[model samples]
Target chain A: MNLYEYEAKRIFEAGGIPVPPAVRITKPEELAKVHFGYPLTLKCQVMSGGRGKAGGIKFAKDLEEGKALAKDLLQLVIKGSKTESLLVEPMVSIAKELYLAVTLDRERGCPIFIASAEGGIEIESSHNVLTEPIPFPYHPYVGRNLAAKLGLKGAVMAKVADLANKLYKVFESKDLDLAEINPLVITKGDDVLALDGKIIINDDSIGRQPAFKGWMEAHLVDMSPRERRAKMTDLNLVELDGNIGILCNGAGLTMATMDMVKAFGGQPGNFLDAGGGSDQKKTLAALELVNENPAVDVILLNILGGITACDEVAGALVEFMKKYPERQMVVRLRGNNQDVAEKMLAASGLKLYPDLEEAVKEAVSRSKNATKKPALAAKA
Target chain B: MILVDKHTKVVVQGATGKMGAAHTKRMLDYGTNIVAGVTPGKGGEKIHNVPVFDTVMEAVKTTGATCSVIFVPPYLALDAGYEALDAGISLLVLITEGIPPQDTAKLAAAVKAKGAKLIGPNCPGIITPGQSLIGILPGSIFKSGPVGMVSKSGTLTYEIALALTESGYGQSTCVGTGGDPIKGLDYQEVLSMFEHDPATEVIVMIGEIGGNAEEEAAAFIKKNVKKPVIGYIAGQTAPPGKRMGHAGAIISGGKGTAESKLEAFKANGVRVAMTPGEVAKQVAEAIKQPAKA
Candidate 1:
């Protein structure tokens, strides 16, 4: 899960990293009492990147300017995410910007620390970046090594190395998937300050890190209502702009189904994985989600039941199809009580294909036919 | 001939849980020689007539089991793995998913140090057609034949195996190496074993969007594996940064794309299949051709 910049900076501060003092304003009206002084930065709190280019960040020279910027930012919608809060902080005058981060290197099966002397906006494409693999216990000397590799020396090198060690400690202690400080700036006073921060807590480690539970809850408030509903039902649903809705039993299968849909010249409207071992309620919930979308001309259910039984899915579909007669559906059910599911679907006036290709082809053609007729009728 | 066969003795960890009991019963019914079970405090109990022990060491000592399949929760998976390793199990299969990558890193290092083979902490385990079933894969889909299979998905593996069996290309063995960022065994390791197995002829590898495991396997095949290999990668249309069901199925920073993995396979002379049915067709065609000199 991605943390807001304020949350990430809080963790950085707890890890002994230097950060500019900041206050969170949930409402534009709350900016009236702000006393952090002039020349402050107001940043909209959203989960997406490129906030600066999206006009989510602004500067204020006085209280009136700060309030005006806060009002505008709080009402801004950048990249489909609205700003729910604004981070107010004193602006820093930077002598230079440097990039520092630690992330899991899956290829090497270990964590790696990345640093670069050139930082800020273009740091992602910078050629001066250096990466160092860290093993268990995170050797103390590794930070100094990274500092030296970034072409640092003297007191600056010592301070950078010390800051790197502290960042590593926070990364390890918080069970983070990623801990990044983009533009770790060197101030005019020659002191280092983490200008911006990003932390991704590993989803599986959430149970162990109880302190992050509240933060995660707050993060959920930022998600779309449909996403939150899907979360409550334990379904993986990602909405898209297409005409066909896909429901599958596993993640790989769901994606493969989407690929097949696209291959057959049909656009997939959403990705909904009912998960293995889903019952009637979960299946109904998934169907309801897809049915609610008017853009979905057809719903395709591709289930390769291993732990999940075909009969359970068929039972749910039969009930759902009966209630929603206008909705078109094409199902391919196989494995684990396949005969029973086929019999049940047949009795419900529904056809179940044993072949996935045939089912996908049928769904795509049916969706095209259904969509074409409406346009022809309107023209006539 | 690879990791498990009909005569291999299997032990179950976390045997008292729902998944453990269900798959254990299925494995035993499929002719696997399940000798014992381990559930920490449930030592004196017997599940499906298989004796249970307090620890992996006790189970190993009492039953002389050489292999263990774990079904514990994710948080306890590392401990269960360590117990199985300390008890000297030569081959360990972890059926539990959601194990933290950090824990997997530690467990993998220890497994290497002990000179033992670890299959998966989030995998479906291994199956030798018509002989032994050590994981949670559906046993009815498999048939004894010449095709050797390895995949990173559980249900997708079943789907592919089913397609192959229906198309008359039965499998010698099928292994799901789990879908996590860090896994115990990789495609290269399993591919090498399939290369030397006498009963296996063609190989079918199912990969998805994540990591460089498939690329590494392609490199290994180009140099060492002489057998004709059919490859299929899922998630061709998956967007970047979204974990599509599996924790390890995300494409990050323009790497681990399905297009890249498939291209790597094609460059290495491996036949690439767009669908599972296509995979079966390619395998059948490869089997009909005579071995290259």
Candidate 2:
């Protein structure tokens, strides 16, 4: 779960990390009453990196330019990340820049703190760090020792150590995979401020972390009735940008299916998992999600059933197609009750393939034909 | 004989519960000598003709069950593991999830200190072919064969086993190490055992995205093991830094990505399959390939 920059900053602020005062404005009108001083930096907060390089940041000489940049950013979308709001802050002219971040080092099976004297573009230069891997799941003494090497001392050093310890606690406690601060700038007065923050919480630990639970509860957004039905069934349904909508069970299989589509020279628009088990209603809901995607030219059903019976899924697919006749369907069945499901699918005049390799090939070929059929027939 | 021998009677913690009851019936159905179950406040209750006790020690003493399978919740899973460890159980299999990372580190330490072999915390327990059906995988998918199977995903274990069985390959033992980020037995640990097992001709590994377990396993496979091992990593196109529903399916930084794992395996000259169905064929071919002169 990747939090937007502002949300991550809020978490950092709560942990006593200093950040320049900032506000998120969705519209130019919202910046009308803004009282922040000159030399303001307007940044469009998108999830992807390279924001500065992507022209997502602007330095406005005056309030009018700042407001105009904010409005322009609000109207633009960069790399599919919406610029719904701009993070406005008083720009700090830095004397020196240091970059530091804390993330789970999966290879060592522990958290890691990556730090370098270089900051900004140097930090983003791909290979900034020149230190050996530090053992995380750290000892408190270890934290203090690392802090000392950073020239941190006195109450301030202690404070940074305390912050590191607390950050470790939050990383472990909240099941966060990442807690980063890029270009942790040093002001002319030698104050450390986290200029940008990023965090990716462990989704598995969402069950254990109350903070994430509370965030979800507080920010539960509205959805359409169809989406509401899909949500009620514990299935996450999102439309994709391509015409091939996939319905797969396991995460690995979903990716494998998506790759197979790409391997067969087809584009996959979305990834949807119906989980391990699905009754008829959940299957129907999943199909509805696929049909709702306008970019979807054909829906692919790929499932390796263990606890879930393929027969039941096939039955659901047949039933769903009866009501939603506008979309084409391709079903691939394997595992339990696969034979019966294939028989049913065959009888329904729907395309069914046993092998994933062959199935993806046919699905890709068919979708192309479907796309070109109207054009060719209109010419005739 | 695998990690746990046939003579080792087993007790299941959280017995008479949903998962415990289901596994108890299945294990007993498979002729495993499950002697006791532990469920707090449900002592004296019997699940699948196995006696239930409130404490692990009581079950161990009364039923002589030296092995325990745990199906406790996240908060109590660590305690359940500790309880089994304290009871002097030589082998413990945990199938619970959502345990705090710190708690898992502590539990792993304790298990090591007790010299007890732990299987999983979020895994689908372990199984000995034709001996015991101790885990949650459906029994119909497995048959006694010479191949040893170990995996991180529960669903993929069944899929791989089914493929092997269909290909006239039977598993000597199959284990799902679970997908929890902090788990007990990893791929390398399981691979080491498979290398020593005489009955095991080939080891089939199914790994998923997330941590560097696959990369570490590949290194171990390259350096130490002489046996032919074929593997298929799940989440080929998984986005970096995104968790793939499974607790352990997180691609942190640049590590744990399929591309990195693939590169490691390729660099090591390990035979890798593009799909789960390809695992059996590759393993069969690798087993027949003569060692480099």
Each candidate's fnat, listed in order, reads: 0.54, 0.34
Each candidate: how many clashes? Answer: 0, 5
Docking class of 2: acceptable
Residues B65-124 of candidate 1 have per-residue lDDT tens digits of: 999999999989989898999999989999887787888887887888899999986788
What local lDDT does model 2 show for residue A216?
Answer: 45
User: How well does chain B match by TM-score in each candidate?
Assistant: 0.98, 0.95
Candidate 2 lDDT over residue span B40-114, tens digit each:
888988887788999998998887788888888777887888889888898888877556655666677678778
Which candidate tops TM-score? 1
lDDT of 2 by residue, A1-380 (tens): 67778888888888777888987888777776567778888888776677888889898888788778887877666766666478888889786676666765434444577766576754545574633244433577655765676776676566556656656665665667777777777777767788888887754456777777755432223333444445456665543456688888765567677767876788886767776657677877787776666567778888777656788898898888677655677777787678888888786787777666677777787678766222111111
Off by over 4 Å in 1: A32-36, A214-224, A371-380, B290-293
Clashing pairs in 2: A243-A296, A243-A297, B123-B178, B145-B170, B210-B250
